[model samples]
Target: MREKNHVRNVNNRNEMEAVGDYYLNNKTLGKGEMKMEAAMKMRIADIGDEIVSNKGIKGKVEMVKENSVIIEILENLSDREYVNNRTVVSHKNYVII
Candidate 1:
């Protein structure tokens, strides 16, 4: 699976809390009727939690945002200089482990 993380702008999400009520955006809701989507409860992912990305990369949750979590990539698979091992992964792109 493609990793839909936004590591391109890691510094931009420095203000999100490390834990709290995490909400889902339209992407996370996926394809569904509007009414049912609106009535769904939010998912929770706290700091220190382990999550695996859609691409199968494991990470430790460092911060929690409105619709994503800042994670320290557990596996160093990228060879690029900017990977940094930290990225913002959408709630829908990863599963808590």
Candidate 2:
């Protein structure tokens, strides 16, 4: 039983280290620097459409593309909004819901 517990702890530690490595290798910026474009996903909260605001939509980036991202939005209703690629920084901190 003690050996089994020790092995489980080691496995957990290894999993955590792997997660840390992925974040360190993939993270784009140092403190206060603008995020790398490759590291960002399209956010529905950043869209200029009123519908996004009304539905309180929040999104997670599923995939990034050359000019856009595929995102999964969490909201009560569904709709599409077009956002300018350059305007994301202005809305990065907005509360989606």
Candidate 3:
């Protein structure tokens, strides 16, 4: 009885823990544990800069704001969920291509 319970617990724990897979791709994540891209902070994004959003929406930067940038949708690699031609994406949500 006790042996069977231990086996189940072990299996469950193993399934829940996948910590070392690229750090970002993990099931066992704690607070403040994150890795940012170098281009996200170092690169200066500007108007006409091509970027791909986190959701795989490809677009050009139409305007730049303090926190986010206005993008004109050029190509959507994901799906047709985006019904608008222009979108506002945060700096953290996209990378300049």
Q: lDDT of each prediction vs. the true structure?
A: 0.53, 0.28, 0.55
User: Which digits, one per residue and each the tens of the lDDT, describe model 1 over residues 1-97?
Assistant: 3233522222322111111122233223232432243235235579998765544456799999988999997764333243477888887766564
Q: Rank the candidates by lDDT, best first.
A: 3, 1, 2
Instruction: Tell me model 2's lDDT, rounded to 2 decimals.
Output: 0.28
Best by TM-score: 3
RMSD of each predicted structure: 12.4, 14.9, 12.9
- Per-residue lDDT of candidate 3, residues 8-58 (tens digit): 112322121111111122332232232244232435469998876655567
Residue range 31-84, candidate 2, lDDT tens digits: 223223212532543233321211223344444454443445533221345452
Q: Give the TM-score of candidate 1.
A: 0.50
Per-candidate TM-score against the hidden true structure: 0.50, 0.23, 0.56
Candidate 2 residue pairs that clash: none
Best by lDDT: 3
For each of the candidates, give the backbone clash count.
0, 0, 0
